[model samples]
Target: MSRKKTNIEKEIRALKKRLAKKQSRKRKVRIVARSVISKSKTVIFDPCAICGVREATTRDHVPPKAIFPQPRPTMITVPACSECNNGASDFDDLFKVYLSMQATGKSEIATRLFKERTVRTLQRNKSLLAKIKAESKSLLVENTEGESEEKLGVLWDSEAHDHVVERTIRGLYYHHSKKVLANDAELKVQWLKSIPEEIESILELLTEQVIGDDQVRYKYYIAPEDPRHSVWLFDFYGAHYTSGYTEPTDS
Candidate 1:
């Protein structure tokens, strides 16, 4: 072969070697990821986080992955049964829509998720849209001048919201305590936009700490003796807030 032909062959061989190295590195990274996931699953052994009866067969993200930006680096997962894991998708979608509508400009993540996931979900599930529309109502409130003003808002589905809250509490409880909650433990949920005076006093009595940043923050207070009885406060986008509590069934 001529000099130019030999040089071309050598360059081609060099490129192939580089490509092979890149592919091998990618395979190694994938193997590591799988190993991490497997180890995480083994770390928690418990019944379903929701019903607390059946054995947990699947690991579930505390907040569904759909609510977060693509490729969320560190997601919190909890032990869960198949039903609790899969059944919450519709509620999660609805919650995202409500959160996005309320968020508007406060959170870039919420805005992007609204456009990408919520809108598409609404378009696909016409019944969900109708349900939301049907539940919407208007109320008349008096102004400073004693004039009635119309206020409009969507009526939230309490059952669905409660489901999300309960699951989240269970996940956080396990994440923090590294112990499964009792199967007979009862959870009480209350959705609040601001901390009630009573709750504030209770928080003062318990341990308090904040997690995450302005975009998403969790301010929680857990009783030292019984974690099941605790207060969880979630702040999204530094604007929307939802607070709730879980207590023993008898309490």
Candidate 2:
């Protein structure tokens, strides 16, 4: 009985050792695979990522600081020239309000932005309020009670949302892949209301990056051969989702 017990103990110890070695190998393999597939590289912004024409004099926050509440999250900024940075100021303000309104129900932070800053901005900027009221459309949408109610919804101008998102995509592309997207590379943008089946599948396979307590969530895939060919799924405040791609244009 003693002899048999000793043999079993030896076998058990050997099995554990083998298992540990196997797991270690698996871990290393996974690390190598992820590194190779993702091609995560350090970003350097000597020249502006936007225009690529002028030297980067300042850093511009991708989503803009106005989009967040007080004591904002660690800034996610990219290199930009004074011209690009200053030109985007008004657009950033407008984006904050529009984003807050659309994403009010998405998260607590979003709610705070809407109640805290958005309202104040509207109060101060009557022209902006007038513009919104002018562009809004009355539509019959089903409420929680399953009854159709006439509600007013803002019909966002393509320029209103596209410009900010375009800049964001460029910044993120440079951040992740360390590739500056040229001006010739045209961006295709789609603000997704209901995600398509095919796109949903693709999104699952991409690398995910979330910023500032779920303020901005990005799932992206960049081609290994050409970083310019990249696909992005951007979720803002959990309510708004945008799918965009930067592809090489004929130009």
Candidate 3:
């Protein structure tokens, strides 16, 4: 084949491949949209799952949409007020970036997210990058080969992490009970990574109450005595941990 002709043929094949992938993504998005529409019809009357103060104006995906490949069939959404929905974006971005960094090699999605989204965000916001760098600390992380190496890891904002956890707990509560928690309901989050020996018994009890058959990625347990008190366990690309606790508020 002539050199120019061969190059033309290659370009045509690449274009066709891109078009096919785009169409496939579109189809998946349509399917998810239909599912959201159908589900929204049933829960439109409910109040915002997060704060429970305002009427639910829209649906918010439990795990922020940015973390998933476009048009994921597993995407689940819950009712949220505009404030609750829009307020989560910054924290979501931070959490996803943290997870992406942690799962860089093990997950292609995480790598792509880090390169395409997180890098761009950091580049655009020099001040934010500076703040993160300023707050960073040195930590010893074990590599796949089991050798510990000192690394500078960003100090994640506790408030941002807590907000994401609180929002997720509210979404899960709605998913399970079809009810909005009271606006005054208090959420206490405890990271399971460094729990004290005294709390080991409580953790064991919570472990036994796990509700889901699928324990690979995520599992949750609602206290049998009171639905308001629940626990969520998450395994994000092998970063396994549990968080979330609902404390009763005075009536």
Candidate 4:
């Protein structure tokens, strides 16, 4: 029975992976179009999704392909420029936060937060979740290896306890979120309330650390090539916000 259950879980994960890939293509196209429209003088400037850098020159996906492997809006992309986008590629920092949230079992919330249109809110959530994951991982790694015995400050026995470490980190986060959910009145009022606001707070703190300020300085525009797609222009501004990411910013 346990083996059967494991297989079923694996199959489900595979399906989700395929779905994410399909969505990634769509998101990429959408963002491309939006960039063109924004350049046509249709809209205004907004903060970059990942780094909070204003006057963004590109549209980069948040949660990165490395962490999630597929793209959805929340899982899809963010407003960034060439510099920040390149920086994000080297590290899956934001995606790690979402992973931590998932490992902690706020997986649903983590999924929803990234699908948002607003970069600030998305980053806020991503940063908080990342911090939570990092701390939880550290604590677990520490307690398990009996670090007190060694004079070394670092937890050396990480790989030896991979499953336990991962589970402990995720479980702790889930438990904390569950507690918050229990006490949150608004959450009870609204079915599951919105995780975006909570995530926003997380990103705000993270931005201060990574980007030096919580302010994003990018211009958002719709795609010019495809009118149906919604993409944001990083450096240039257009007249209107499109429904999709790939629409041109100049049109």
* Best by the TM-score measure: 2
Global lDDT of each candidate: 0.60, 0.70, 0.58, 0.29
lDDT of 3 by residue, 76-172 (tens): 6898879989989989887776666655666565566678777888898888788988888899999879999997777666666666766776787
- Please give the RMSD of candidate 4 to the true structure: 20.8
Runs of candidate 2 exceeding 4 Å displacement: 1-45, 143-150
Tell me the tens digit of each residue's lDDT in model 1 across 1-251: 67765554444334323323322111000000111226457443456655565567898888666566564537778877798789888777777777665665566766766678777888998998898789878889776799999965677776666667667767777777765555435555555554444334333333443332344567564555555555566666664666555545564
**What's the lDDT of the predicted structure labeled candidate 2?**
0.70
**Full-model lDDT, candidate 4:** 0.29
Model 3 lDDT at residue 189: 57
Q: Mind giving the per-residue lDDT tens digits that candidate 4 earns over 125-190?
A: 676535444554332223346664322122222221222222221222222222111111110000
Q: Could you tell me the C-alpha RMSD of candidate 2 in Å?
A: 15.1
**Cα TM-score per model:** 0.67, 0.76, 0.68, 0.22
lDDT for model 3 comes to: 0.58
Ranking by lDDT: 2, 1, 3, 4
Best candidate according to lDDT: 2
How far does residue 83 in candidate 4 sit from its true spot (Å)? 2.0
Q: What is every candidate's alpha-carbon RMSD to the true fold?
A: 21.4, 15.1, 19.7, 20.8
The per-candidate count of clashes, in order, stands at 0, 0, 0, 70
